[model samples]
Target: MTEHKPGGDLTLGGQRVHERLTREEPDLVARVLARIQAEVADYRRLPVEELAGDIARITQQTVRAFARCLREDRDLNAAELRQIGASAVRRAEEGFPLEAVLAAYHVGTREIFAVGSADAGSADVADLLEVADRTLAFVGTVTGAVTRGYLEELRTKIGQEHTARRTLLSVLADGGPVDAVARSAGIALPARYLVLSVELGPHADEATPGIDADIAIRRKLRRFLAAFEHSCGDGVLASLDGPGGLVLLPLAGRLSAVPEWGSLLGTAGRAAGVDVLAAADTAAPSEVREVAGRTGEVLDVLRWFGRPPGLYRLDDVLVEYQLTRPGEARDRLAAVLAPLDAHPELVETLSTYLELDTNRRRTAARLHVHPNTVDYRLRRVRDLTDIDPLHPAGLPRIIAALAARRASLPR
Candidate 1:
């Protein structure tokens, strides 16, 4: 088979088309740009005087390059391709979507064909066809180059932003001075902030067997956290580190004003298949590390206790928080509840009784059992653990032991 070449008849036809196009270059360029501006919404939205000047300059350059390629019978070189690609990068930075930029290219191509056809009325049909084919191929090549450049620039910008955000988060997490870090990050530090620790829930696959799966999970978590931060407004900041992440919420007024934070975080966490645990008190910038440590402690206690998946706060589990601190004390408290392990129902009943403030009727209603059954379970618990639920003196130890037992269970 013979190799195909774009010379001979095609080259001769290209030369003729080139001459004709050059003769009508000014009129054709103006018509093509006008059509693009009329058809593409983004082009129309640009400032009329500035946009027209840019279009005119680009159109002239494109027409001159196309004519030269047809006359010379050569593919566009790297320099020419880079010129077109640079235009795409500018369009992307100016906030034009890829689709819109591509649409403008299509409009320009259509106008070029229309103008070529009208101008070449007396020329051979075969020659016109050859020019049309070559023009279309050139457009495709340029379009591909532009798309690549646009995506490359976009990825570069995203990577830079990610680096900056991670740097700021690291400074904050390390308890660095807020004013300097905030200024560097282009953010304002609030007077008070709440720190949250988020992690994949019990159901999530912690040990997924592959680097790819781990990377995918990290990407998913990042996207979810980004969306959550956006929904929480301007003062919210978040960062991911390995399997867990942190979110810092800046409060303008009292924390009481944002009672919905827990629910909102819960909804976001559940949607992302993660659990969110937060510190109870707001911290100043200087105390960020302290609050962050407390948030981690809360997460540890919740994990050890086998709590259900959801949002948790330090204040909500204060008894467990305190009990889990002294390792020996926690062990002894766990031992206190070990005798009731054989009768798990008794432990459950006792927990419910305490939760309902020692009200047998309320505990029964909550447990969906008879009040007599609740009373019997409480008595059994008291006998097995040597801690009376009704006796005021032993109540604190009993409650602490129960909380420790809950924390010690495997989730």
Candidate 2:
């Protein structure tokens, strides 16, 4: 067993080329920067004096590293690869286009080839070809490292921003130092926010046997985020956990265009292929803590009554909201429907009747029953509860009782 020295096999011309490249590395690096500034608009827009110095330093380092690799006929060592990666990350942080970065490397390589092979005799053809092959390999390796480093930095940056936004939302909703958190998160606190508690219903694919439920849920979540981002831009903040979570949308004073939330929710639901239900209310920054809880309760009441997919504000569900609160009255009201527990059909008919504005025919149509059957069920409900659902006094009481029962029951 012996040491493998691939570079020992380099032809005379190849060795000369490697030395020239190493000695002229500074000039080669400058040429690379000049080419990039000429060809790439993004690079040209950077502050010329300061950025050019920085680019020249890194480009010289890169050129020397490749020269060493060429001389040894070996690949970049771990430390060299790390240096390349660090430089790439810096460029990404400075908002440099990856295409321009790669173009700079190509320019450097082309310059090296032009000088290295300029006076190559016919006998040096093999070495020149070998160098060309190695240069191509070098490009592949360096570009791969550059891309990986650039994307990783970008992803970390995005994740940090997301975490900061989430933290800001928490402070706003849970009573904390709002100004400090907003400053740290780089968010401007608005005078008011339309706080929302959202509940996303399962998509049809979630229940299908062969489809992956998690994938369906993620797809819906992405659509929801994209829709909200498109409509509200960066002003809308949210924390989504599984089926639902809190959202805060910044208000832009009287002159700001407030989105028609109903239409937006509809578009979100359609895009996500899921049912969207949200409870919303507006509040000043200082009042967000209170409105946040109120919005959550509003959503709870809406869900307890099995409301259809849509947006609901406190005003829309005031009666149900009041009746669902805990008390002896609520318990007694809930008990009014207890007798009909064994007679589910009667309870269903009465609930539907009340829901449809006491319209008998609409209840019959909704329940898929004849009008005669609807009448019979109403009579049975009256006998069982000792309350006629049609009477003005009885209507409100029964509606409250049903709401209380639904609230107390498991969802």
lDDT of 1 by residue, 18-125 (tens): 666688898988888889888998888888775677667777777877777877888788898888888888877776798888887778877766665664545456
Q: Which one is best on lDDT?
A: 2
TM-score of each: 0.73, 0.83
Q: Residues 292-320, candidate 2, lDDT per residue (tens digit)?
A: 99999899898767688898889999888
Candidate 1 residue 28 C-alpha distance from true site, Å: 2.5
Candidate 2 backbone collisions, by pair: none
What would the TM-score be for candidate 2 when compared with the true structure? Answer: 0.83
Q: List the residue pairs that clash in candidate 1.
A: 304-407, 305-407
Estimate the lDDT of model 1.
0.73
* Model 2 alpha-carbon miss at residue 228, Å: 2.0
